[model samples]
Target: MKISEFVKQVNTTKDAVRHYEELDLLRPSWKNDVRYYSPKDVGDFHAIKEMQSVGFSLKDVQAIFNLKRTDGCGSEKLIQGFLDSLDKELEAVVKAEEELQQKKSKITNMILELKQL
Candidate 1:
């Protein structure tokens, strides 16, 4: 079906379909200013939505898609990339938590000082 029909059936916007196509995630057939999608497009959409639902970034989706193209199967390189990203994210989370705790301590000290005045 055409992109419009596909969007209606899949509950997605036309722009979103185009964006995914641009990202090389979907390869809908194109002819005469119109695009048509098949089951593959639907699968791509589902894959993207599923990943996004689970908090995967667009870069992550693109990386996974690229890996699939190269490896034709799950690759250890992709797995390692994901692990590295996860580790970096975890480190950022820990740093943010430490910053939050420091701010809490500072605020508590100010409150105590004000209370004694």
Candidate 2:
């Protein structure tokens, strides 16, 4: 499909899609300067969106995509790298959650002390 259809199908702005193309993150088959996206591109679009949602920077996404292209999706090293990134992210989230919970507990204790006065 054309860029318009591709953007609509992927539920993303044309500018964002263009930016992805410019970043070498997403590529559609091109002919005469026109881009045509295959149905399979839908999966690619979802994958990109998913990565972005999980706090993966465009550069990180690009690296993963490059690895997949060069070594195939089933490559153990690529899978390990992805898993490592996720693990790091998870650790950060867990730490943040712990800090927030501690803050909440402190606030609750303060409120209880004020009520006792």
Candidate 3:
């Protein structure tokens, strides 16, 4: 498919795909002036997006691709470290949200008491 169609199908912008291409994340099979993407390319594009959504930087994603290209596998230890860090961050976020909720409830009660006065 053409870049435009691929963008539409993937629900992404042309610039984003171009940026991915520039990062060597994904490339067209044929680069004879006009670019075309294959189904595999689309899958690779989705993988990049998914990784980004889950806190993987483009550089990290590129490293994964390089590893795969050269050795057919990414570093398990690196991926595990990311997962462990993400777990700790998620715990912190959840605790912060719970504290915020408690604070909100206290503020709401204060407002109600002032209204009653």
Instruction: List model 3 lDDT by residue over 16-112, tens digit each.
Output: 9999999999979776788999998899989888877866778878877776666554567656655765676578679999999999999999999
Q: Candidate 1 residues 1-117, lDDT tens each?
A: 997789988899989888888888888887897777898778889988987775678888898888877875468887777677667667877999999999999999999999999
Q: Candidate 2 or 3, higher TM-score?
A: 2
Superposition TM-score, candidate 2 onto the true structure = 0.91
Runs in model 2 deviating more than 4 A are none
User: Against the true structure, whose lDDT is highest?
Assistant: 2
Q: How well does model 2 score by local distance difference test?
A: 0.88
Which of 1 and 3 is the better model by TM-score? Answer: 3
TM-score, every prediction: 0.64, 0.91, 0.65
Kindly indicate the candidate among 2 and 3 with the higher lDDT. 2
Which residue pairs in candidate 2 have backbone atoms (N, alpha carbon, C) closer than 3 angstroms, thus clashing? none
CA shift of 69, model 2, Å? 1.1
**lDDT score of residue 108 within candidate 1:** 100
What is the C-alpha local distance difference test score of candidate 1? 0.83
Best-first order by TM-score: 2, 3, 1
Candidate 3, superposed: residue stretches over 4 Å from native: 73-117
Each candidate: what lDDT? Answer: 0.83, 0.88, 0.83
User: Which stretches of model 1 miss by more than 4 angstroms?
Assistant: 73-117
